[model samples]
Target: MNGASALEVIEAHDGTIDLMVTDVIMPEMDGPTLAKEVLKTNPSLPIIFVSGYTEDRFKDEIGDNAHFLPKPFTLQLLAEKVKEVLS
Candidate 1:
Protein backbone atom coordinates (compact mmCIF):
# COMPACT_ATOMS: atom_id res chain seq x y z
CA MET A 1 0.00 0.00 0.00
CA ASN A 2 1.07 3.58 -0.64
CA GLY A 3 1.19 4.95 2.83
CA ALA A 4 -0.11 8.52 3.20
CA SER A 5 0.98 9.57 6.67
CA ALA A 6 4.24 9.31 8.59
CA LEU A 7 2.76 7.17 11.38
CA GLU A 8 -0.39 6.13 9.58
CA VAL A 9 1.03 2.69 8.79
CA ILE A 10 -0.91 1.05 11.62
CA GLU A 11 -4.16 1.85 9.84
CA ALA A 12 -2.86 0.71 6.47
CA HIS A 13 -3.02 -2.97 7.34
CA ASP A 14 -6.10 -5.03 8.19
CA GLY A 15 -4.68 -6.02 11.61
CA THR A 16 -3.98 -9.74 11.13
CA ILE A 17 -0.67 -9.21 9.40
CA ASP A 18 1.65 -12.22 9.13
CA LEU A 19 4.62 -10.52 7.52
CA MET A 20 5.80 -7.05 6.61
CA VAL A 21 7.89 -6.66 3.47
CA THR A 22 8.96 -3.05 3.23
CA ASP A 23 11.63 -1.09 1.42
CA VAL A 24 14.52 0.40 3.36
CA ILE A 25 13.70 3.80 1.99
CA MET A 26 10.21 5.14 1.45
CA PRO A 27 8.59 8.53 1.19
CA GLU A 28 7.01 8.20 4.62
CA MET A 29 9.43 6.16 6.69
CA ASP A 30 12.37 3.81 6.47
CA GLY A 31 11.92 0.06 6.96
CA PRO A 32 13.80 -0.50 10.22
CA THR A 33 12.07 2.26 12.18
CA LEU A 34 8.73 1.03 10.95
CA ALA A 35 9.55 -2.54 11.95
CA LYS A 36 10.51 -1.55 15.45
CA GLU A 37 7.25 0.29 15.98
CA VAL A 38 5.21 -2.41 14.31
CA LEU A 39 6.66 -4.95 16.75
CA LYS A 40 5.29 -3.03 19.71
CA THR A 41 1.86 -4.30 18.71
CA ASN A 42 2.77 -7.69 17.26
CA PRO A 43 5.84 -8.90 19.01
CA SER A 44 6.00 -12.12 17.02
CA LEU A 45 5.84 -10.40 13.66
CA PRO A 46 8.40 -11.11 10.95
CA ILE A 47 9.96 -8.37 8.82
CA ILE A 48 11.81 -8.63 5.53
CA PHE A 49 13.77 -5.58 4.43
CA VAL A 50 14.44 -4.89 0.74
CA SER A 51 17.01 -2.41 -0.49
CA GLY A 52 19.59 -1.95 -3.21
CA TYR A 53 22.19 -1.04 -0.61
CA THR A 54 24.61 -3.38 1.08
CA GLU A 55 23.81 -5.39 4.23
CA ASP A 56 25.92 -2.89 6.14
CA ARG A 57 23.71 -0.10 4.84
CA PHE A 58 21.15 -0.43 7.60
CA LYS A 59 22.71 -2.95 9.93
CA ASP A 60 22.91 -0.33 12.64
CA GLU A 61 19.20 0.40 12.35
CA ILE A 62 17.85 -3.15 12.55
CA GLY A 63 18.08 -5.33 15.59
CA ASP A 64 18.27 -9.13 15.71
CA ASN A 65 14.60 -9.64 14.83
CA ALA A 66 14.38 -8.66 11.18
CA HIS A 67 15.76 -10.27 8.03
CA PHE A 68 17.30 -8.64 4.98
CA LEU A 69 16.33 -9.25 1.37
CA PRO A 70 18.51 -7.15 -0.90
CA LYS A 71 16.71 -5.38 -3.69
CA PRO A 72 16.41 -6.90 -7.21
CA PHE A 73 15.74 -10.28 -5.63
CA THR A 74 13.75 -12.75 -7.62
CA LEU A 75 10.34 -13.75 -6.35
CA GLN A 76 11.84 -17.14 -5.56
CA LEU A 77 14.70 -15.57 -3.65
CA LEU A 78 12.37 -13.34 -1.68
CA ALA A 79 10.13 -16.30 -0.96
CA GLU A 80 13.06 -18.37 0.20
CA LYS A 81 14.29 -15.63 2.54
CA VAL A 82 10.84 -15.28 3.98
CA LYS A 83 10.60 -19.00 4.50
CA GLU A 84 14.01 -19.01 6.13
CA VAL A 85 13.03 -16.18 8.44
CA LEU A 86 9.71 -17.73 9.33
CA SER A 87 11.28 -21.08 9.95
Candidate 2:
Protein backbone atom coordinates (compact mmCIF):
# COMPACT_ATOMS: atom_id res chain seq x y z
CA MET A 1 0.00 0.00 0.00
CA ASN A 2 2.89 2.33 0.68
CA GLY A 3 4.66 2.48 -2.67
CA ALA A 4 1.86 1.21 -4.89
CA SER A 5 -0.27 3.59 -6.90
CA ALA A 6 -3.22 4.95 -4.94
CA LEU A 7 -5.68 3.61 -7.46
CA GLU A 8 -4.22 0.14 -7.26
CA VAL A 9 -4.42 0.21 -3.53
CA ILE A 10 -7.86 1.75 -3.59
CA GLU A 11 -9.28 -0.78 -6.01
CA ALA A 12 -7.97 -3.48 -3.73
CA HIS A 13 -9.98 -2.21 -0.78
CA ASP A 14 -13.07 -4.15 0.25
CA GLY A 15 -15.12 -1.77 2.36
CA THR A 16 -13.02 -2.16 5.50
CA ILE A 17 -11.18 1.10 5.01
CA ASP A 18 -11.86 3.95 7.40
CA LEU A 19 -8.96 6.23 6.53
CA MET A 20 -6.19 6.64 3.98
CA VAL A 21 -2.90 8.42 4.70
CA THR A 22 -0.67 8.77 1.66
CA ASP A 23 2.35 10.67 0.53
CA VAL A 24 1.33 13.35 -1.96
CA ILE A 25 4.30 13.06 -4.30
CA MET A 26 4.12 9.45 -5.26
CA PRO A 27 5.39 8.03 -8.56
CA GLU A 28 1.99 7.11 -10.02
CA MET A 29 -1.54 8.38 -9.60
CA ASP A 30 -0.53 10.81 -6.84
CA GLY A 31 -2.25 10.84 -3.50
CA PRO A 32 -5.05 13.06 -4.69
CA THR A 33 -5.94 10.83 -7.61
CA LEU A 34 -6.03 7.85 -5.30
CA ALA A 35 -8.17 9.63 -2.73
CA LYS A 36 -10.50 11.10 -5.32
CA GLU A 37 -11.12 7.75 -6.94
CA VAL A 38 -11.65 6.10 -3.59
CA LEU A 39 -14.10 8.84 -2.63
CA LYS A 40 -16.10 8.08 -5.71
CA THR A 41 -16.75 4.66 -4.25
CA ASN A 42 -16.53 5.54 -0.56
CA PRO A 43 -17.21 9.18 0.01
CA SER A 44 -17.10 8.96 3.77
CA LEU A 45 -13.56 7.66 4.02
CA PRO A 46 -11.20 10.11 5.67
CA ILE A 47 -7.95 10.97 3.85
CA ILE A 48 -4.77 12.53 5.22
CA PHE A 49 -1.82 13.50 3.02
CA VAL A 50 1.80 13.85 4.12
CA SER A 51 4.26 15.46 1.83
CA GLY A 52 7.46 17.44 1.84
CA TYR A 53 5.97 19.67 -0.84
CA THR A 54 3.77 22.69 -0.35
CA GLU A 55 0.01 22.24 -0.40
CA ASP A 56 -0.53 25.08 -2.86
CA ARG A 57 1.68 23.38 -5.42
CA PHE A 58 -0.66 20.42 -5.37
CA LYS A 59 -3.88 22.24 -4.67
CA ASP A 60 -5.51 21.26 -7.95
CA GLU A 61 -4.84 17.59 -7.26
CA ILE A 62 -5.93 17.22 -3.69
CA GLY A 63 -9.50 16.76 -2.68
CA ASP A 64 -11.36 19.37 -0.64
CA ASN A 65 -11.90 17.02 2.26
CA ALA A 66 -8.29 15.87 2.38
CA HIS A 67 -6.16 16.97 5.33
CA PHE A 68 -2.45 17.71 4.88
CA LEU A 69 0.78 17.43 6.82
CA PRO A 70 3.84 19.24 5.58
CA LYS A 71 7.08 17.40 5.32
CA PRO A 72 9.43 16.95 8.27
CA PHE A 73 6.43 16.28 10.48
CA THR A 74 6.80 14.57 13.82
CA LEU A 75 5.17 11.37 14.99
CA GLN A 76 2.87 13.42 17.18
CA LEU A 77 1.75 15.44 14.21
CA LEU A 78 1.07 12.36 12.10
CA ALA A 79 -0.83 10.80 15.01
CA GLU A 80 -2.80 13.99 15.49
CA LYS A 81 -3.65 14.13 11.78
CA VAL A 82 -4.81 10.54 11.82
CA LYS A 83 -6.92 11.21 14.90
CA GLU A 84 -8.38 14.32 13.36
CA VAL A 85 -9.28 12.49 10.17
CA LEU A 86 -10.91 9.66 12.08
CA SER A 87 -12.75 12.00 14.41
Candidate 3:
Protein backbone atom coordinates (compact mmCIF):
# COMPACT_ATOMS: atom_id res chain seq x y z
CA MET A 1 0.00 0.00 0.00
CA ASN A 2 0.95 3.64 -0.36
CA GLY A 3 2.37 5.71 2.50
CA ALA A 4 -0.83 7.63 3.13
CA SER A 5 -2.85 4.45 3.28
CA ALA A 6 -0.25 2.88 5.52
CA LEU A 7 -0.40 5.90 7.82
CA GLU A 8 -4.16 5.55 7.94
CA VAL A 9 -3.81 1.93 8.90
CA ILE A 10 -1.36 2.85 11.63
CA GLU A 11 -3.70 5.46 12.97
CA ALA A 12 -6.60 3.05 12.88
CA HIS A 13 -4.59 0.52 14.83
CA ASP A 14 -3.77 3.15 17.50
CA GLY A 15 -0.17 3.24 16.27
CA THR A 16 0.68 0.00 17.99
CA ILE A 17 2.79 -1.45 15.24
CA ASP A 18 5.82 -3.55 16.09
CA LEU A 19 7.60 -3.12 12.78
CA MET A 20 7.21 -1.46 9.37
CA VAL A 21 8.55 -2.41 5.94
CA THR A 22 8.38 0.25 3.25
CA ASP A 23 9.96 1.10 -0.07
CA VAL A 24 12.34 4.05 -0.32
CA ILE A 25 10.43 5.56 -3.21
CA MET A 26 6.63 5.68 -3.26
CA PRO A 27 3.81 7.65 -4.85
CA GLU A 28 2.07 9.47 -2.00
CA MET A 29 4.97 9.75 0.44
CA ASP A 30 8.54 8.60 0.36
CA GLY A 31 9.89 6.06 2.84
CA PRO A 32 11.92 8.59 4.81
CA THR A 33 8.94 10.88 5.15
CA LEU A 34 6.79 8.05 6.36
CA ALA A 35 9.49 7.01 8.77
CA LYS A 36 9.74 10.54 10.16
CA GLU A 37 6.00 10.77 10.62
CA VAL A 38 5.77 7.40 12.31
CA LEU A 39 8.77 8.11 14.47
CA LYS A 40 7.13 11.23 15.80
CA THR A 41 4.79 9.07 17.87
CA ASN A 42 6.60 5.79 18.03
CA PRO A 43 10.18 6.73 18.47
CA SER A 44 11.46 3.22 19.00
CA LEU A 45 9.53 1.61 16.18
CA PRO A 46 11.69 -0.50 13.94
CA ILE A 47 11.36 0.18 10.22
CA ILE A 48 12.83 -1.62 7.23
CA PHE A 49 13.06 0.32 3.99
CA VAL A 50 13.52 -1.65 0.78
CA SER A 51 14.66 0.01 -2.42
CA GLY A 52 16.16 -0.68 -5.82
CA TYR A 53 18.67 2.05 -5.10
CA THR A 54 21.67 1.83 -2.84
CA GLU A 55 21.49 2.47 0.91
CA ASP A 56 23.79 5.47 0.57
CA ARG A 57 20.96 7.31 -1.16
CA PHE A 58 19.00 7.42 2.10
CA LYS A 59 21.71 7.35 4.72
CA ASP A 60 20.99 10.72 6.29
CA GLU A 61 17.21 10.37 6.29
CA ILE A 62 17.17 6.92 7.88
CA GLY A 63 17.73 7.48 11.57
CA ASP A 64 17.78 5.28 14.61
CA ASN A 65 15.62 2.15 14.62
CA ALA A 66 15.36 2.31 10.82
CA HIS A 67 17.21 0.07 8.37
CA PHE A 68 17.68 -0.41 4.63
CA LEU A 69 17.27 -3.56 2.58
CA PRO A 70 18.28 -3.45 -1.05
CA LYS A 71 15.86 -4.85 -3.60
CA PRO A 72 16.07 -8.34 -5.14
CA PHE A 73 16.67 -9.75 -1.67
CA THR A 74 15.97 -13.34 -0.84
CA LEU A 75 13.47 -14.52 1.73
CA GLN A 76 16.32 -15.67 3.90
CA LEU A 77 17.93 -12.24 3.81
CA LEU A 78 14.66 -10.51 4.55
CA ALA A 79 14.08 -12.82 7.47
CA GLU A 80 17.55 -12.20 8.73
CA LYS A 81 17.10 -8.44 8.53
CA VAL A 82 13.79 -8.64 10.35
CA LYS A 83 15.32 -10.72 13.09
CA GLU A 84 18.29 -8.42 13.37
CA VAL A 85 16.20 -5.27 13.58
CA LEU A 86 13.60 -6.70 15.93
CA SER A 87 16.31 -7.85 18.24
TM-score of each: 0.81, 0.82, 0.91
TM-score, structure 1 vs. true: 0.81
lDDT values for all models: 0.77, 0.79, 0.87
Candidate 2 deviation (Cα RMSD): 2.1
**Tens digit of lDDT per residue, candidate 1, span 1-87?**
432353475656666878778887877667777777778878888888888998786788977667888878898998899789878
Compared with the true structure, the alpha-carbon lDDT of candidate 3 equals 0.87
> Model 2: which ten-residue window has the lowest total lDDT?
1-10
Candidate 2 ranges beyond 4 A from true positions: 1-6
A best-first ranking of the candidates according to their lDDT comes to 3, 2, 1
Which candidate number maximizes lDDT? 3
Clash pairs, candidate 3, are none
Ranking by TM-score: 3, 2, 1
Model 3 per-residue lDDT tens digits across residues 4-69: 888878878953689999998988988899888988888888999999999887788886556889
* Backbone clashes under 3 angstroms, per model: 0, 0, 0
Model 2: per-residue Cα lDDT over 4-63, one tens digit each: 555776688676888878888777566777777778888988888888989999877885
Q: What is the overall TM-score of model 2 with all chains considered together?
A: 0.82
